[model samples]
Target: MDPAAGLTDVRAASPTTGDDLVTLDGVAKTYTTATGTTQALSPTSLAIRRGEFLSVVGPSGCGKSTLLTMISGLVPPTAGEVRIDGELVDRPYRHCGIAFQTSVLLEWRSVLDNVLLQFEMRGIDPAPHRDKAVALLDSLGLEGSSRLYPRELSGGMKQRVSIARALIHDPSLLLMDEPFSAVDALTRDQLSMDLQQVCMDRGRDLTVLFITHHIEEAVFLGDRVLVMTPRPGRIAEVIDIDLPRPRRLEDAGREKQAAYAAHIRETFSRVGVYRRNQHEGGQA
Candidate 1:
């Protein structure tokens, strides 16, 4: 099944909001190694409307993670600037929440306490946020596991807890970096569905920047998917997913899903960043 077969290309028009929630102006990054300096990202510009779900996919070492760090203000960009709600992001911004590939839960903390850790870090009273934490856990299907330790949970449960923790603070922007890549395939699928629901439920208020290596995942979850080139990474394409909202994996036939995946795969191939043999036969 050639997924790209019979698919038409669609591009998203830039939104004309009075103020974009997030903006990257000619952002670029360079790293100084012991031997020499290496350029990681080329000058790239982007604007994210409030409450939009944007997925970014690219080959390894393409500065996908670096883009997230700059947006979160955890790391400074070598050039250009990242702004959230029109304010320059020069340090760790309290308006953003982040989750990485690993669950990174505190083994000693109960699930509820783990979710409340964000409050602790912000010097806010956890008491005020306890109900919200419990609600978030319940929403993610972790209702009864609040009292359980991280070690007692399955891989999927731990990731759910991580997500709950990230959302407990009610951040305006959520940055997720390959959050489901470490879980089993079945669990990954389930997590994908759950996260999709979360985005739909909160899409009117929360903006998400999701980074993943899986083309299918990116296509399934993004309103617009941004594809980057290999090393010295820059945006190669920004594909608007024209599918209906509240999408299910089974909603679009394999062909449609394959089409989306195939388009991204083709883009990578054109840049000499992807090889056909890297993926399994008949798998997106």
Candidate 2:
């Protein structure tokens, strides 16, 4: 199953769809430093379908984070627009949640309090959401650790807490930036499976935009993987993963998964992004 077959250049692809949860219209970003100005992202356009798991892979400093920030409305684009559910996004949306490479948990707060932080920030009463918070922790395998502080938990446990916090509000979209990159390989694999299960359990209402450097992780987690060029990034290719659902790393489609990863790597090579020093070298 060649994921890249029958697809035109990403810009030439369909720009809008009835199911689109996110639409980027010629969005571009530029940063001005004390020295001068730098273009972090090229003018790029694409649509993310509702409930879709979209993974973005690229070499370091390729504006992958910039793209995510634009979608989250944390930073305004220098040109064009970002729309969520057909509404133009000009500010950070309350319906979106984000997690990053680090757990960023407060050592003083218990896991339960940390999970409830989202509600607190939004001025929502935490008492009514406590049960929901507990369930989220349990769902992420942090049931017994809710009363424990961050310093008392393992790295994986802390990350699970972070995930629980992100979902406590039940956001429409979740943006994860290398969430599993800091964990051990075994822990990373488990986190990936747990995340997949989270998406499945939440059904089609929850969409995810995941950014990682690992090609294998991108293919395994994304419904369609978007590959990007180097600095001043632009879409190089978008590969539709034709693998079956409820995907497990140990599934029988190991060969197919490898092929998908290979296709992404080949695309990266062609775009001059696969050099030795650029590779991150991990399952992620």
Give the Cα lDDT of each candidate. 0.86, 0.87
lDDT of 1 by residue, 1-284 (tens): 33343322212223436657888888899999999999999877888878888999998999999999999999999999988988999999888789999999999999999999999988988988788888899999898889999999998999999999999888899999999999998898889889999988996689999999988999899988888889998887777787887888875447666688888888787766856574557444
Candidate 1 regions exceeding 4 Å error are 1-19, 275-284
Kindly report which residue stretches of model 2 are placed more than 4 angstroms away from their true locations once superposed. Answer: 1-8, 276-284
Q: Name the top lDDT candidate.
A: 2
lDDT of 2 by residue, 1-284 (tens): 45445434767543566998999989999999999999999888999988989999999989999999999999999998999999999999779888989999988889999989899899988989988889889999887778999999989999999999988898999999989999998898898999999999987889999999988889889998888899989888887888878997875246888888888877887787856553666422
